[model samples]
Target: MSSPKVQLRLNGIRKSFPGKEAATQVLDGLTFDIHERDFVSIIGPSGCGKTTVFNIIAGLVDPDDGVMLYRGQEVESLRGRVGYMMQKDLLFPWRTVLDNVLLGLETKGIDPKRALDTAREYLSTFGLSGFENSYPKMLSGGMRQRVALIRTLVLDPDILLLDEPFSALDYQTRLYLEGILMEAVETFHKTVILVTHDIDEAVALSKRVVVLSQRPARVKAVHDIALNEHSPIAARSDPRFSGYFHTLCAELDIQTRKSA
Candidate 1:
């Protein structure tokens, strides 16, 4: 099968935050390419600026230098092209489950009736039909994430930037949500760029995994996962899984120590 087209490109991207003493460089010459409908994970240490890169891609922050391109067209800002979900679910406390899902559509001036219709369909697909009128505080971590994912998809963005969306969940719940997220991404034909710290999660959910070097993060290694088993949990059984995890850990350890 042919590979997907390059949907987004980052070349020599750099970002720094001003400090009282000196500038704190977060990303230095950060470069990567994300293909259409591809699930790519960026993994690195805690302070490696993985999320900073996502912020730049989503136009939440502009890079200090280098090019950001979409479909080979250079973009000054991707405000309308990308949908970003942070590590926190950040669901509006007062909005009903249905309302929260429709919030983006509401913001985008979509018809209310149409948004409601679409949200109900997604609620069923999300296995959240019975809780349409429920509040965020009443839902579990996994359920809230499901709602958050649905909310992001409701807008139909070109690229989905997931910054550790599953980090807050428990072990079993995380595994379950991975399956749900994979299904949702495929259902929407989305090009997902996931910023995560979990090596196993990255290997299981991604078509390619990009490891970053320490602060002033840059792409250290990109491993294209090849496994016949089609599910995140199933991929754990593959003999190659352990090797990938070990290598990723070793690379991360080296980066951490080098920075220290």
Candidate 2:
């Protein structure tokens, strides 16, 4: 037997919803492969089905066409294998930070005592040690997002699906969270797929950036981002960063117009 492998594969995945008079196609023949430990970003214009791509991957919605394979096998359900962090933190107001983070484990029927210990371990690792008992309302926006991330991480999912996880924060907070996310993904060696409209964020964090076209989206381009510093925080100021940013932005603009 070989070592356990983890990866997500998509082949000709498609989705459609009822439109005003007909089925409104969202994703059309979208195909991609996310490697076992790759940090990937998906960038596209508004209404380009970027989130739909993620929704299908998460099994929150079924694809009307094609296959989604996990580790070379078809993914029949997404109950425990995928950890999703949405735009909103979505923490329950009543639960303390630690309890919120342990929700996944509790759902899995992990003993509350053991799960609490595990959640604490993640909090400490992610720079969230002391806030375990604090309510979600007590933390800053950045801190709350950090707890949200810990909530996902504590579940030990092989892949993380981030849907514009930083779009709601201020510029400074977003930058800080980028650093934190980069560190977490690197340290844990987790496969991540981040969906965002921010070209700079895509270029800043992804090993490869996937760009999609407008509504009824399809893959327009795939770019391998080369940076001297692999860390998102340090890579921002590297002399070569802006060149990649401009190239991606230009491609996005061209695609947006072509689809328009």
Query: Among all windows of ten consecutive residues in candidate 1, which has the lowest summed lDDT?
Result: 251-260
Candidate 2 TM-score, C-alpha based: 0.92
Model 1, residue 190: what's the lDDT? 89
Q: What is the TM-score of each candidate against the true structure?
A: 0.94, 0.92
Prediction RMSDs, each to the true structure: 3.0, 3.7
Residue-level lDDT tens digits of model 1 in 73-149? 99976787687887799899999999999988999888889989998998998889999999999998889988999
Q: What is candidate 2's lDDT per residue for 1-260, written digit by digit as tens?
A: 57434488888988899888999999999988788798889998898898887788777888899888888888754647778998999998999998899889999999888997899899998888888899999999999999999898888888899999999999999998998888888788889999998888888898889989888999999898878676767788888788888888887774433443
Question: How far is 175's C-alpha from truth in model 1 (Å)?
Answer: 0.8
Task: List residue ranges in candidate 2 displaced over 4 A.
Answer: 1-6, 254-260
235, model 1: CA deviation in Å? 1.1
